[model samples]
Target: MLIKGYDDGPLVAGESLLPRPGFWSNYLMAICGNEPGASYVPEWFGDDGADADDLSEVLFDPERWPVFRAPAQGGPGVVVIYRNLLGDYGIDYLLTHPGRSHAQHVASWEGDLSGTGLSWDELIRIADTPATGEGVKDSAARLLLVLPLLTDPDLPDTAPARLTAALSEAGAPQDTASTTAEHLLAQLTRRSQHDPTWESPLSGA
Candidate 1:
């Protein structure tokens, strides 16, 4: 079967889903048998640059969808992050916000195997928890740690601003907590930029 990957972190390749006004409600009603409402919009499904199609349409009525010359699995899968407006805005807020919010946002996207259908508010809450276990910890630990220093609670800062600060600000406090925090922060920075939100403000710091 052809699989699609959607993410809400940032625009990146391999994303199949795109969240819009009412994507979640539609998806739930159509696939998961839940009806959050028909407020979810699948903006990426049309013949746009990303060329995303509704999974249900493809599955129920294959004739309407473009014909794939090769096998579905062999064909390229589209990976999309968050498509719902509420979800997207929530994530954006988390990414741009200061304090613990930045950390949780990074962790959610980092640990997200598939970026589609995520709730922005949930991600922000998760990011705040310093101890969310090893899996989530490894996912975006470095990104989360750098947030505290980079964020200026008084001044609204962009993700880049925070990241830049982290790069410049060196020599954090030397203590057990500090050392562990630094080590985890290092893991996120030293890795490659494959994920969607890596370039976002929260990811860098």
Candidate 2:
């Protein structure tokens, strides 16, 4: 797909994984310590021969999405969502291998920033070369973690305002929250000088 706003950008060759609109929203909800809507409530499951009942355990019933996990380098693995069928989803807990696509152990993370023009490799290069943030990797990751929700058109509030509330909820002082939210939005604005696109923030940053 042209990926909407990226119409003037590169024509990438990968298809989007994770149920869009729902995926990142789910991730954002999880990070915000909220329930990820009944949508994530499994209608059925396929992981580890799990039945619908067992899915409660798979998703961490009591803790809920708050416990949604990801692995670190050389550490224990975590469950990742995947397509079970056209409209179905399942999770795979890689118990044996440490995650590597985004580098489980190191601070290194690589993934498409969707509408954003910046390549993760480019971000790393800038960071490593210095003089700039090369921008903070974790800062970028924080944006990515919530960009979908922040940018969501269906949201009742504007992106910047929504992010500010989110930051405040996460413990940033109101002033800090407002400034950081504006900074994040500014980062996206400055990043796409040509046409438009954007964040790669990590969870709970």
Candidate 3:
């Protein structure tokens, strides 16, 4: 899966007009899925200068998708961090956004494993919580951490008897896991929205 991995971090003016890591290897690492597959990035992305395709189409291409439009022409674009459903594989992709050296927006794509058929905003709308904005985001983050276990393919009888089981597998307590999962799912009830809550990691979880 070619997950968006571009970082919108401040780049020294006039650094390089390249993709996320400014290197091919790093870009490959970011876009490849559970296992690396042979792929050629379009030239417009500034990699090999190979034939290019409209980014939107490439992004929607079912072949490499579920994750990978790689080899994007670089400048400024949105970088979305994504991990595979199994959580073993992850990528940060820089999506090309013309004329914007920095991503106007950034967020995680959880791949809708919640199965409630609710959008992120809908989930948030239905939620009533004392959790702070950052706290909610943290809750959201923890839910994502346990989703893979809940949906694990190899789980024979049942992936997990309950959410707590999955949380325990993730080395998180039941209460903490439940809280975070609630926050993450809160917004999914409503339409997905761009509202983001960001904080310094130093603030501690």
Candidate 4:
């Protein structure tokens, strides 16, 4: 007897069950491809020449950019850092899932530099801590380190401002933490264009 599978794997005599792929499995495969390549750019990272409106669509669309989870070993959740034209920063601890309709947001710090009151050394210290050790503190610290890099000096002064405003209007703060994360993620994605260092967080590094 012959058995058929979705992607065509080895055939076995006994009954074999093939579990359906999860939402992320298919989504990631389509965007990133079955094998890694230079062409793969995550949905979180807006396309080249994309404007604030384009970024807003990339960030706020849950179907496109779902919430990420930590490893089963227990580590820090995903952290996103964003900076506006006024030099304000936002740090968030994201608890979101692809299965959920909304994301949960826990703001560690939002608005203004003084709000966080963290020095560079302090911030680094926090980031250096293992994610599995100090979950919240580690995420916050990583965001702090990433915040400054999010701003691209060469970009127009209005870019960050426009993106921030657009994100706010897209129900970022009022909607869910996941939505707010998308806003910050948009900025990080933009920064990655100029600086490769900004790509680390997205890769779960």
Instruction: TM-score for candidate 2, please give it.
Output: 0.27
Between 3 and 4, whose lDDT is larger?
Answer: 4
Clashes of each: 30, 19, 28, 1
User: Tens-digit lDDT track for model 1 on 1-205?
Assistant: 1212222222322112212222222222222112233232232111222222444333223122211111012111111122223323211112222232211222222222222222222223333343421112221223332232221212223333332332223222222223333332333223322444423232323
The sequence of per-residue lDDT tens digits that candidate 2 reaches over residues 1-205 is 1222223332222113222222332333322222223222221111122333343332332222221222223332222222122232322222113333431221111221232222333232222332211111233233343242222212234556756765554444564567555555554444344333333223222
Prediction 3 TM-score vs. true: 0.21
Candidate 4 lDDT tens digits, 1-205: 1111111222121101011112111222122232223333323222222343344443334232222222112322333322121342233333323344443343333321111122223223334443343123333323322343232223444444433443333222333334334344443344335543322222332
Off by over 4 Å in 2: 1-144, 148-157, 195-205
Model 4 TM-score? 0.24
lDDT of 3 by residue, 102-153 (tens): 4322233333222212222222222222232211122222332222212211
What is the descending TM-score order? Answer: 2, 4, 3, 1
Q: What is the lDDT of residue 43 in candidate 1?
A: 28
Q: Could you tell me which 10 consecutive residues in candidate 1 have the lowest summed lDDT? A: 67-76
Distance from true position, residue 77, model 4, in Å? Answer: 8.9
* Per-model RMSD to reference: 19.3, 18.0, 18.4, 19.0
Q: Which candidate is the best by TM-score?
A: 2
